[model samples]
Target: MNGTEEIGCCGAYCGTCREYLKTCKGCKPGYLDGSRDQSRAKCRMKKCCLTRGHITCGDCGEYESCETIQSFLSHPGYKYGKYRQALEFIRAHGHAAFLNAAKHWTNAYGRYPEQDP
Candidate 1:
């Protein structure tokens, strides 16, 4: 089920997406210009955050814990919070599961304008 192309807006790998490849009959990754390497098997969201040692957007010290997450939330193609879902889904199903739901801890009891968690 490994893949190179994607259809799901949250950057879910469509090559592994049973539904898209089945329905469309054809599709592939965009940047086929580069050679495929073992390390190439990485998630876009996870890689970016990990570069800062923040595995997820929630781990960031920024006031907008959900800033990067929001831009994803506001994507024109995504109907649901699929990007958020991806974060959650991976934990339960592991790397192979790209269709995961995102879970975050918002300041409900605390006052607004939270700078850190």
Candidate 2:
């Protein structure tokens, strides 16, 4: 993670989101690059991770049953369940491996297909 690689705390690749290209830079602290948009800044998952000192929700013990997480996962935007999948990948492997998986992931808008997640 170069610190600007927009991978959200929930594991959704912000890089693949159209809104991210237009606004966000990645998941670094807001002061680092000021890339977090209003929505990103308000994200519950992000808040949870930051408060818990975690880089992602995969590091949380309650991720699977978390109501906040489940609610976010139910959003219609992720019809493909990419967030859930990415979290699973991160937990099973690691953030680096999850990033590698995101590099090859073609389902999410294909924004950074050439970059290493």
Candidate 3:
């Protein structure tokens, strides 16, 4: 299987999730065609880790006690269990864990990830 098949426990594709794509863009060291506005997916993990000096959620100093992470989890419509599962999976299996658990948070509770307007 090509890299895309390496599924994440969160039901995400490690190879194509916007965060990974952002990492790819980081490699190129330039703004992707329209990433400045488009392609800015609303994943807290990606946003926090990329913009807030965290390499991974598990690496955060607050870890099990982080308010940002906990607040996100408290939102029932957001599927806290699944998100935590993904985080736990990442802690255990690294990025590969997201493959199985990468279920989209965007679709939960009839909510699609909101795009910046």
Candidate 4:
């Protein structure tokens, strides 16, 4: 599938997620369809995006300063820089570019070498 289908509203590359397809679908679909994964179902970022009629935070005007996204990214459990990088990439290059670059990602989280700061 095109990697866009696996992009999360919170900027995660679900395509590389260990649980993707096994226990979870990508964030957008899972959020829309009422995911069985409780975490996905209850995701604030997903809820916010859907509520705002946005596919992802990249579509929001407040992306950079959004408290919800900031809270999510800063959560200790989600200390990966890749998530932020993905969102920044989306903002700078658009989803297609992010997806194309992310196609080779092997890990669900963590900075891709090519995107390392």
Candidate 5:
């Protein structure tokens, strides 16, 4: 599958994840694989997206106000900021553009400059 398909519902890039292709196979696929106990199975975002038939939270009308995503993005951990940034990027540019810019992302989470409006 392409890199866009590897992005998690929570905006994590599975392509840059260490567990990807080892213990997991991206968010949707890993959750559906069902052969092993994948972490995505227990992911709240993943379940919510699948239930709503959305590839990512960016597809949701309530993306900006959703409690689940807000909670995740507000975690004390710094890494969650990157997830929030990713979601914002998706909202502004679309998944294809996000994936293209994300190709240079070294960590599973990091900053990407916002596009000029």
Candidate 6:
């Protein structure tokens, strides 16, 4: 793990996303590779957090009301409930702790073993 996997700015676990090793390196690079959806590189949620100098929206003071994050989470295509769980865990336990726990679970394609059926 590159240690960048657990801290996706909008709360998804890059370590567990199919794009992690192939197309994306998570929000920290601002989706620099452009292999996923090209528009994802311009994600408002990631841009908002980075522009504010935050590691993740969970680190932000206004995370709850941040329209960008709220909209992302509300998208019907957003199926990762673990994203919210990861955010809460990060907020309560810290990023390092989340990373350590996540390390045991990420599969090659980047989805957790238990999550993929």
| TM-score preference between candidates 5 and 6, better one | 5
TM-score computed on alpha carbons, candidate 5:
0.81
Clashing pairs in 4: none
What is the lDDT of every predicted structure here?
A: 0.38, 0.64, 0.45, 0.72, 0.77, 0.64
- Which residue pairs collide, candidate 2? 6-26
- Ranked by TM-score from best down, the candidates are 5, 4, 6, 2, 3, 1
Give the per-residue lDDT of model 1 (tens digit) for 6-91. Answer: 32323333444345535643223322333433245454544354445443443445514545556665677543344455444443
Best by TM-score: 5
lDDT of 5 by residue, 26-66 (tens): 66774554654544367788778767877789789988789
Using TM-score as the measure, name the better of candidate 2 and candidate 5: 5
Which is the better candidate, 1 or 6, if ranked by TM-score? Answer: 6
Q: TM-score for model 3? A: 0.44
Q: Estimate each model's TM-score.
A: 0.32, 0.66, 0.44, 0.75, 0.81, 0.67
For model 6 the local lDDT of residue 96 reads: 79
What lDDT tens digits, residue by residue, belong to model 4 across residues 1-117? 244658788888788778887877566665555554535457788778777877678779998789889877777665346677778778877888777777777876554435444
Q: List the residue pairs that clash in candidate 5.
A: none
Quote the positional error of residue 16 for candidate 1 in Å: 8.2
lDDT of 2: 0.64
CA RMSD, predictions in order: 11.4, 5.7, 10.9, 4.1, 3.0, 6.6
Which window of ten consecutive residues has the lowest lDDT sum in model 1?
A: 102-111
Deviation in Å, model 5, residue 79 alpha carbon: 0.8
Give a tens-digit lDDT track for model 6, residues 56-86.
7888988778777766766665344556666
Candidate 1 accuracy as lDDT: 0.38
Q: Which residue pairs of candidate 1 clash?
A: 84-102, 85-100, 85-101, 85-102, 89-100
